[model samples]
Target: MTLFTDIGALVASAIGGMQADGILPGGLDLGPVTVEPPRDAGHGDMATNAAMVLAKPAGKKPRDIAEALAPRLAADPRVASAEVAGPGFINLRLETSVWQEVPRAVIAAGTGYGRSTMGGGRKVNVEYVSANPTGPLHVGHTRGAVFGDALASLLDFAGWDVTREYYINDGGAQVDVLARSVYLRYLEAHGQEVEFADGTYPGEYLIAVGEALKAEVGDAYMGKPEAEWLEAVRSFATDAMMELIREDLKLLGVRMDHFFSEKSLYGTGRIESAIDTLKSKDLIYRGTLEPPKGKTPEDWEPREQTLFRSTAHGDDVDRPIMKSDGAWTYFAPDIAYHWDKVSRGYDALIDVFGADHGGYVKRMKAAVSALSDGRVPLDIKLCQLVKLYKDGEPFKMSKRAGTFVTLRDVVDEVGPDVTRFVMLTRKNDAPLDFDFGKVLEQSKENPVFYVQYAHARVHSVLRKARDAGLDVSDTALAGADVAQLDHEAELAVAKKLAEWPRLVEIAAKGHEPHRVAFFLYDLASDFHALWNRGNDQPELRFLQEDQPATSAAKIALARAVSVVISAGLGILGVAPVEEMR
Candidate 1:
């Protein structure tokens, strides 16, 4: 279905035929051989490094192998010419019929044009946005949520059975602080004056939670001690906060398949079982870690503790899993969580964390490796910060969320489509500047607007063709004599469409969804270029007066571009607009 992949198979077959004729040695590795578009358009349509990769193995000169390979490739009906470039690379220019078939293939496949079976139905669990269930999600968590959600969708499109998961950090002491904070609000609901100390949360958002709690209990805990009501209040507060987090994620179109609670790992011997699995492999030991390099804390002391021999599996040093006082460290629960994921029979695991969690990467990787017996691969992606700007000044914090800008703030100001598209304009590891004024501007500098505008223009062309008594449906366009679309400008857009399948496989294999956004922008640029060129050359216009055949051919190419843009936007969780407002 992919033009580049088909051509690559043809090149491989030609080389295989060369081996059969005894022109070259047999059994040479062809894994390094690749067929892709030439970087310079003038060189040729496609280029391959077959000769360069096989020359050393066959004990022959690269140019000599290229010379023999060119003739065999040129013999194919689809290839127009095959020329040996510098060194050993062979550039191929396919027949016009080959490029013309691209639009027809796109029309047949519709939005499913780029979906691939590369994953072979393997299971992958992507865990992201595991922020503490203490408050509403902030901008930092928003980036992780968007990246993880898109990655899961991309993997699914590549034929992977992906599970989107979120780990709730509800077992930590922070939930206790939330309980105390809610207690203050609960007291305030009964006409009692209270002052929030430095340690308690003072956000006005929690006032509603307090009011709700008062409605439920009816002053049952008004005269109770902290010990009597702490557990119940903590449970209520975490549930409320998670509901808030879910609503915030709904605003940005992020949905998780599973929500695992850290508290569930406790009192269930899950942590003990996970550590036992590691102990059976001799990865668990009792040792004292050397003092860290930076500065020592006032309570820092070296003590023999239950440790994980993480260095055995590629970590920088051994990590402690249990404290000297018989309490599990923070790392224990994380190992247990990953062990739970490994037990579920996932072939791959991905963790999307904020940039500040860089230290957890190696240790977590080591734990998965030891637990999975080197079977399941783990990839951790760290999303950098998103800096907000408005009118050339830094955006202020949200008064509702107390300390940071909530995800709802961004999605509410600029609709969900804009928020999701703009978030992925940059790679996850790179810092992104979200300018309120610039993203809303209807210009080429704003990628979301430019891409949306290109899709809208395609619809305008369809409307104009319909009014002119031309059948512009996809079926009608697919059967048109597309050979009329031989202009370089028109063919350029088809060539870009042909890259969709290859691009999807590449992005899915790398576990990077930002590449989808980048590809869409380039495709939009090519489409816009073709549109602008039509303005100056009346013959290049999509609809011609009294020329239904020519107009249908041109309209087919325009519809193909829109189809690809829609598919790419779906991978990024963005909705393509038919009309830009």
Candidate 2:
């Protein structure tokens, strides 16, 4: 259960008691009141700002409000003491038994202990790793894939109906370039030498696609004109590249619920329908935009074009939907894609874009806002670059990807678990340095290993307790005399366990799955600290020689730590280890 939320409710009830006793206004606003852990643990177990936030609204002094509310809170059986601190903040000391029960509750719930209902089953569409289907996925795309997948898992754990989606960029000039490149490979498969032109892909990864095309068509299109084979070849190359991308994602444990094709928006009346909806709202117009910032008017060319009044919805300027050549701009299909998502009635939409696309943020949000009439909210999370390091030096490019390191290369150097966990060890907006040399180390500096070691430690304790003739099953541990876990160090680990549900809600609300990685690191640190403390205090050890009940009680606490670690790692898409090798 959420201990902090329960305590916050008690604080609200105390405020009500004050109002009922005529010490404060009857209808004072208590919405801003909060109960949380004190900034300094030495102060108390928990703290509340109920007095200060209500002082001005209640027309009473801060200290006076706190004085009136303290006794009401202290009267609860769960609250051992409630004392007013500096400037009317109330610090609460909960009963020892309350903290002692946290581990037992964790054992009772197992890995599901931290699951939250904050989302209320609302639907969310998370679109990420929408790299163009022109080649294999690179390291940059790997970061986005891991971040988006972890976020979807975190939202799912927090009770949201999450759809993992990838928008395929298959409608633009890039796909045409891919078709020509694959044609060259097909010629090479036919024992004909070919040269890759300036605008064509030259990666060796397409050799198999070329050979497969040779097998399928048997050189029928070898001498055909561009119009006779462009469409079919484009379809073949796009499908093959997408197959490669799917395999790359599978290597990293990322699976999309849907693959939306940009090409489908064309020739299906969908693009026109979305633009027509905007036109009916009077948002479309033929206008010439002003010269861009830092550009002289002479350097800018103005033309009457189909534009969307994006400025009305918080964008910096209006955006053109169609070019002077009577063809759609790159933004036109993107707008239609998001429009399709909004029309599907998702409660919210989240796009995981690369940091280079930062300029498109406001305009895309404006499109969704205008299309949905502000009914759905769009959040765009941009992932910054990932710099890879190995052997104490920066890792260079991969020949397979031609210009950059591919996702498969990183996953092969270190397995998918290390690749995914290290990708999320930093904020999405912050640059992450992924060092192959450091991630696999057994030292505490590596968060992945640190968390896994903690989980393994608990399993180790369970095995030892079982060998000592103590019942260490979850049911047995959950039913043990948990009251024996009264030491300060033991209770500290339990207190950390109590924060799991709150941490889940916090991470889910911000759509930041990296926070889950950070929380697991902290939880592991606390568990490790307690494990070290058992060395000096023989009675503090999880296993006692003859006291089966006492050993079970302590093993319960250790097992609870493992349970939370597994749940946190599960959200991060990292499989928890049962034992360290």
Tens-place lDDT digits, model 1, residues 1-581 = 69999999999999999999999999999999999888998999999999999999999999999999999999999999999999989999999889988998998899999999999999999999989998888888888999999999999999999999999999899999999999999999988999989588888889999999999998899989999999999999999999999999888999999999999999999999999999999999989888787747665788788999999999999999988789999999999999999999999999999999999999999999999999999999999999999977998856477877888888888888888888898899999999899999999999999888989999999988888888989989889899999998888899999999999999999988999998898899999998899899988999988889999899999999999899988988989888876
Query: TM-scores of the models, in the given order?
Result: 0.97, 0.98
| Candidate 2 lDDT, 346-430, residue by residue in tens | 9999999999999999999999999999999999999999998875799674647787789999999889999999999999999
Candidate 2, poorest ten consecutive residues by summed lDDT: 395-404
Clashing pairs in 2: none
lDDT agreement of model 1 with the native: 0.92
User: How displaced is residue 38 in candidate 1, in Å?
Assistant: 2.3
Go through the candidates in order and give the clash count of each: 0, 0
Q: Which segments of candidate 2 are over 4 A away from where they belong?
A: 26-29
